[model samples]
Target: MYRAIKYKIPVVTAWSAPGTALLVTLFPDISLNEAVAAYITSAVVIFFIGITGYFDKLLSWIPQEVAAGMMAGILLQFGLGLFTATDTMPYIVFGMLAVFLLAKRFSPRYAMVWVLIAGVVLSMLLGKINPVTADFSLAIPQFIAPEWTWSSTLNLALPLILVSLSGQFLPGMAIIKLSGYDMPAKPIISATSIASLAVACVGGITIVLASITAALCLGKDAHELKEKRYIAGVANGLFYILGGLFAGSIVMLFSLMPKELIAALAGLALLGAIATNISVAMGKESQRDAALITFLATASGMHFLGLSSVFWGICIGLVAHFLLSQKNRNAVPVTASDSKRV
Candidate 1:
């Protein structure tokens, strides 16, 4: 429906985040059926909730860079996890890295497209793709029959809402701002939430607005230079529907792709985003220590008090920052240029 999608760039960009999830879930022994279901459910909920004025105010409060960093932090583990399984497909990783770096340095606008193209070319040349044995079945949309069990609701639904809110939605706001695009955050949020709800009803995982990778779409480096890039979102929605329908086929195709490919491509895809976030997060001397602590704690994989380390880490870092600031404040002279005795 959106005009930008005609070029297929936005669709590719949109598909990156969910597509990776799809690949990981369907290919490996473990399937993220619940996560996927949650993602879709979340998307729908966000979409509807976005129609409110509250979301507009909320978006204005959060800083864009912080949101981007938060997104990168959320996906850090997923990207790093690729390296662990890259041994089986070294070329995929190498190709992804090579093209990614080249694109970033040379043509930021088309980096993702090039990386994807390179990945495909390298995979074909390396004889890594197994098209012959891949399955081509379609997956009919299956509705999730919600059973009201305390554990299921609390452990799954509640946490998902929180994570999507704090971890996903807030950060998405930051990203929208960071890219210098003052688009209506509420509508987008509501749209994504509603999309999530739709997916959840159909046995899909929740998908909140993607703050981290959304930059890939919004950034100057991702899409081909054009005025109608919004079509990319439309393309993304189409791919989502297609992937949902041909989920079996898509999964089978991804299964044949190398692990290194997934990892390298993911990491490569996120490089620009990561650099921008780190730059902004560390730019201010006041927030540097706190932000770094937040980054490390999130990256550390440590958990305590029934909370993810990322959330706790930011909380702890914020407290430390505030306390340390008080000490510094007490020592500073009340007036500027106070060389004379008061």
Candidate 2:
């Protein structure tokens, strides 16, 4: 709503899961204060990157197949969690899975909604849902001073930028474009980056253009008329504001649900993204070897020299691509005329 009115674009923004995960991975055991500082630094850097319009150049530096492979590798665990949850709660897990598959086939947009309903009903019937003591008070935002650290700059900040750009913004912009919107990327990036910086002090991750939820609004289900689809975006933003006010209550509600249920929900939500990335990663014959190397390296969860597996995945994949391309270029084809001349 804000971005549309202010920048006159139809893009919507949300807190990025991948960006949050990078922060968690970087500062797993750190205090909240320290985490906020790291987030602030990342937001500042991303804000500058957006305003200067350098994101396109940075994105071009990385191969699309390689980036998709890395993203698939990163999201693999969540996809697996949907099945792994069955070990602990077979009935609920399978019930939700069935509902998701059926709904996905018949009415794809409402699959997650059906899955959530099935999970809740099955859990409640099976005595898995726990009672929560709810608080109706508004969430109090805390202010934390930004502290710049060399390690965070190198590790967390850099990865956050890459993942948010590649995993979130790229696909998000693609989704919008596919829906026939000629929305400019620079304004959207600048708006979200500024929003992220503004809210970082309140324990917020980077605000990014959403890919998954944005699809709901972009499709015919949102509105038959394409020009009027901005209403859905505005409605989403209004609900987000309302949800943010009761953030603590929402946290408590999720906390009351079984961990298995949460795991299943997340897995089902990411199924499409996982499938898409995997297809892209293995799609091209020439890029298959490099993409596979990247995927395996990233999914292995290995860390070296204080860097995450995602970094190593891209490095190894790029090296493979370069060498393979060089080999292809240097190989001489033998034809009838060439053989006769030889």
Candidate 3:
């Protein structure tokens, strides 16, 4: 709301799931303080990039297919969990899957909502919901002093910037443009970068322009008049503020749910994203080999030199692309006359 008012453009920000997942994966390798510092550093760097309007240029350096492949690789585990979870709680997982498929077919927009409701109901009936004894309380933001390290910057911050830009901001800006908005990318990126920095100490992830939710607001479903659609953004922000106030309760509630249930929910929720990324990664026949290499490397979970597989996946994929593309470029096309002569 502040940025929208200041810049006179419609902007809505949300916590990026991919960015958060990247940081969460780092916790096992780095200290919480280091992860915090790396995230803050990423936000600061992204802020400068936005202010200077260089994000587009930066994005141009990374191949979209390669980036998509890396993301697909990173998210493969969650997708697999949707099935692996069935091993323990077959009934619950299968029930949620059926509900998701039915809801998706009929009410595509509310599929996840239906899935959640089904999961909760099934869990409750099966005695899977854990008793929560924690008292409801307002979330107190804890400021952790960040400790920056070379590993954290290379492994966490760098991958975070790449994924957040490729996965969130690009799609979000495209949605805005598709919706007939004349919004510039600079202001939105700049605003969210600053917001991410502000909330980094409180364990907030990169706050980027909303992609999926942005589509909902930009559509006629939000409002009949396009100009009045900003009201939906405002309403969304207000709801987010309300949710933030009771973050503690939300956290406690999730913690009390069965881990298998949570895993199933996450897997189903991300199934679309995983499929989309994989399709994009392999869409270009020329880039198929490179994208596949990147995806496999990332999904393999290979780590070397204290860096995650994501970094290596990008490196290997780019190298493969360069070499393979160069080879194709150098290959001479045989002419029909030449073939007849031969």
Candidate 4:
């Protein structure tokens, strides 16, 4: 959701997806099953809602290259953050970077292949992986029995809608707009709302268009062939299906893989996406400073009021974008075109 909200890329979206799992670790009271359940629910919601195909329209808003560049910029810290946490991660970092850079330069279709190979090799060499512990539990849906509590629905659904608009839809539009798109916002937000409700029915938390991470897929830096961008959603959806089916096993496999490896692989995988976000965000004279600040702040790991840096960074970026835009209002008459830029 980061890219859709900000200007991050897709691989970074995958990396960020796993971040939800981090909550499980941090909150010892929450089981891995519960944490993953939320994600799975969100995926199902996203998939069904995506049937409308509105996202395709969003493609026109932003230039593919600029989107890709901004994506890479947004996720710059994730893959590298592994090294700070552990020594073994650096190896994965190297392998990930090597393959990712190679893919960007030569064959983007095989970028994920490089990451998988590196993960396998590194896990074997480092003794971080184990097939034995892999669990095979299917994630059966658990419906959250609805209670027509007006207070609850308003409190829950309203905020979710608002966040999806400001947090997810706005940035999603931004990614496309930054890339050079000019699609309508109503349909996109409407799709997200429908998706959120669907997922909520299946016990999902909130499923919005991923602004921050979707950029990874939409950006050119994601693959050597520019068209490979869509592969992100395809890959993510496939993984989501597989992940939901084998949630237990997936969790175990990741658990066996050292944290450092996961972090590095994630960071490396996101390199292209981050680079794209940064480049595009910097391209505009008016938005450059604010975008950079947002990029740095989001990448900085800072948090406030239980929200991640991504959330706070967007808030700061929006404020900056608004302030800067207003300041330039007299110097440069604001037009409908300029209004649509953010």
Candidates in order, TM-scores: namely 0.74, 0.78, 0.73, 0.65
- Assess each prediction's global lDDT (C-alpha) against the native: 0.60, 0.77, 0.78, 0.55
- Sorted by lDDT (best first), the order is 3, 2, 1, 4
- Encode model 1's per-residue lDDT on 247-316: one tens digit a residue: 8888877887776677777776676667777787778776666667666776676656544555565566
lDDT of 3 at 75: 72
Best by lDDT: 3
Clashing residue pairs found in predicted model 3? none
Angstrom error at residue 339, model 4: 34
* lDDT agreement of model 1 with the native: 0.60
**Which has the greatest TM-score?**
2
How well is each residue in 268-333 modelled by candidate 2, as lDDT tens digits?
887766787788888988888888998898788776764557667778988988888788889887
Better of 1 and 4 by lDDT: 1
Q: Candidate 2 lDDT (Cα, whole model)?
A: 0.77
After superposition, the stretches of candidate 1 with alpha carbons farther than 4 Å from their true spots are 1-68, 75-91, 102-108, 124-127, 133-138, 223-229, 320-337, 340-342
lDDT of 3 by residue, 64-114 (tens): 677667767877888899999999999999999999989978987678789
Model 3 CA lDDT for position 70: 71
- In model 4, the number of clashes is 50
Query: Which is the winner by TM-score between candidate 2 and candidate 4?
Result: 2
